[model samples]
Target: MTAWAVLAGVAARLCALGLTASAAWLIARAAERPDLSALGLAIVAVRAFASARGVFGYLERLAGHDAALGRAAGQRVRLYRALAHGPLPAGSRGAGSGGGEALTHMVADLDAGQDLRLRCALPAIVAGVAGTAAVAFCWALHPASGAVVAAGALAAGLAVPAAAAAAARRLGARLAGARAELAARVMDLTDGRADLVAFGALDFATAAAERQARRLARTERLSGGVSAAALAAGTAVQGLTALGVAWAAAGTGAVTCAVLVLTALVALDAVQPAIPAAQLWVELRPAAARVRRVVRADAALPPDERPHRPAVPGRVALRGVRVRYGDVPALDGVDLDLSPGRSVAVLGESGAGKSTLLAVLAGLVQPGEGLALLRPARGLYQDAHLFAATVRANLLMAKPDAGDAELRAVLDRVRLTGWLDALPEGLSTPVGAGGRGLAGGQRQRLLLARALLADPEVLLLDEPTEALDAATGRAVLAGVLRARHGRTTVVVTHREDALGLFDDIVVMARGRVELHDAGDRQPIGRAFPSA
Candidate 1:
């Protein structure tokens, strides 16, 4: 990365040299034109110089662009790693629904940052050097002419762009922030759209999204307008410098009218790279906070560190666990134990700490004042993600080298065999997000299949059936009941239908364990009290 940055810097300097040389040669050629033979000689020399300059210019972009991309890639990797760390206090977990947006900003927004670094900073530095050299070149021929063109070049490319960049810095940041925000909110809106529609809150959220879109468009337009204005100022400087050269050329010496034209054109070109750079910086201004947010978040955690993988497997226990979410305490001094070959059902309301409790168990959220242990095993909390990969792939995520027979058996037990085979790619076939490829039943079954495949000591299920139909739920419940014979499972649920699968029952209310039982009544309507 350091080497690339250095090479880019050198290229910027080379570009400056090329611009100055091209300008001097052009001005000289313009002055000598008139006699056909003499003009041809000058034109030929100018063409050769132009060709060489073009090559150098291309080289500058080639070397510099890669550096920018490489830097952006490094940042993306860093941010993604931090996101993986869990075990934070419950309130802070899954705080950002716009996670995709943050990732987008890190990669693309940072790419724009690279654009500014290469196109603006590198060239501006180069232009400053070239402007000075062009001034010296003209001065050597005619001192007065050199001074004016050199000064004008600085004003056009260096000074003006720099000033505009400073002014636009805040604007750039806002634009970047807005773009990130737009991306994040879009992700949030999509992820939460079902909830919104179901709750009849679509209009409110949609209006907010629309407002964000309008602001982004307006910011872009304003940025463009600023850039256009900056370009005009650069043009004015170049044109004036050229006019001065033309006047000086009339007095004909080593430099003339032709040289002045080249000087003006070269000066104008200096402004081009700065324009992109300035825009990038401007966009970055708004997103700086977002960048910091992602980069600095959970800074203590490194991306490569996996939570310690315990070799043994058996159960997960939350003992004297106290967890508070936001201003409300979700799990308060709750004591619970789930052992291998047993399952417990958690009962609660929407704000009844059901989800919060699951998060603690899964290592997604940490207990504020207690021990959450995977006793000789592991557990997955509710809100566990299913990547948009193959059904088999999702299952294999827990045990990558799981054999075909193992996968088939697990799939069969969960009753996903029919749906998994329906796909054209079969096992390799992709599943749509949140189970788009599979029916709601299939998606839930796939998640369950994954837990079974892992065969962890303890399984944590939170609203696991929210996406499944009643029939599929029964199959899943049956499978869990079967699973209970061999492993410990803790389920967070409000509905009593799934209760029969558990060997024990625990009810959490006001962050307290409202009810806990080991033996069941063994009554007929075991799953739920069929009213």
Candidate 2:
């Protein structure tokens, strides 16, 4: 399809060149003799070329856009799938951080790659073919004029664009950086507006955003200036080249000279867009590099290459498990064993690696130097995410084919049955962005219901009852444990009331397991001295 588009574009430019030359010849010939009959074939040929030019130009645009859009769609799907399945490596800031700024930048980069095919490569290819044809046609008519036209075409099509591209390359990185910074600042202002106002920092945020906006505007002005200058230079070259063609063909008859000069002028039309195309080519390079880096990294460490799901879904063991974030260790030389159908509660202070341990079990964070073997597990993190979707839609993420009965059962298990029943729309009620419509406890219960619906062999809960009141927290915890009677479960929490219900209790300090005891005997505060 792309080849067809390029061919059509080249054909259209050639037709345009023919139309200009033929019209000039017919007018000059009729002026010499005042005889319309002598110019009949020339007039007919001019109209034919004009008509064909318009038709082929339309076809070229249609085919070119179709091919480019299809390619963009495919690339977007592959990139999204790669990011969805795994965590990006540490310190690698691709799509994970930068929030909407990163996502919008990535999408713009993909569009740039698509435009390279339609705008840069296609125009350059078409111009080359059409310019060569014009030079050859002029040579057949008058050899001396041919040389002059060829020189001008080469200067306009090659030298000017190359210089423009080189200049644009110098500014491309700075322009890209400014745009990203602006995007980040705008997103920060939007997402943090409430917090900024509460802390009396709204003015500070506004000033920062204005600074980034100014930088972006300055960079854009510079880029536009470069593009305009390059275009003006190309047009100047075309005018001088047209004059030279006419001077060289002066001895060939007035009619012939006029025809060749007009041909030279029209041939330059094909080269006029080349300067901007070259600038775009240079501008797309950094974005392409960023995209390729992410795609290549994703390819190197595929998400599916992790440890397989255990066959019997019973024991989970980790030995000498270690994970380092930069120089500091988040989990260091930790060992744990979870027996089948037993509940283990991990108690720790804020940064005691309890969450990291759960991540290791859930196969989210790979161990640096250790062995971790576990069955398929579903995790409910302390900050569980909820989309801006309906109640049923969110629940369907856990089990896509679940009916209303299954959904209602899981909601009941999490003690959200009464709350959901009281709603006007029940399962159909909308959960606003990040579950904004619901209270913190309601959101937590919904997340718990989702995890339960998944029914994995192992359940990992990170502060699952943190959002609820004392009475409600204890009831929800009991219900969760009861529902998982025959499955392995790991709970990471600071709460003490639920500690007695677990079969084993593990306390973590720093990055290591400090104590492990049977839940029945040891007091919660004694096990966790700081707590």
TM-score of each candidate? 0.55, 0.65
* Top model number, lDDT: 2
Model 2, 158-265: lDDT tens per residue? 999999999898788788788888888888788778889999999998999999888889988998898889999999999998899978988888999999999999
Model 2: how far residue 261 lies from native, Å:
2.4
- lDDT of every predicted structure (CA atoms): 0.64, 0.80
Candidate 1, 32-97: lDDT as tens digits = 565566556545655665565566667667666776677667766765554543322233323423
What RMSD does each model have against the real structure? 8.7, 6.7
Q: Pairing residues by index, what is the TM-score of model 1?
A: 0.55
Instruction: Kindly give the stretch of ten consecutive residues in candidate 1 with the minimal lDDT sum.
Output: 85-94
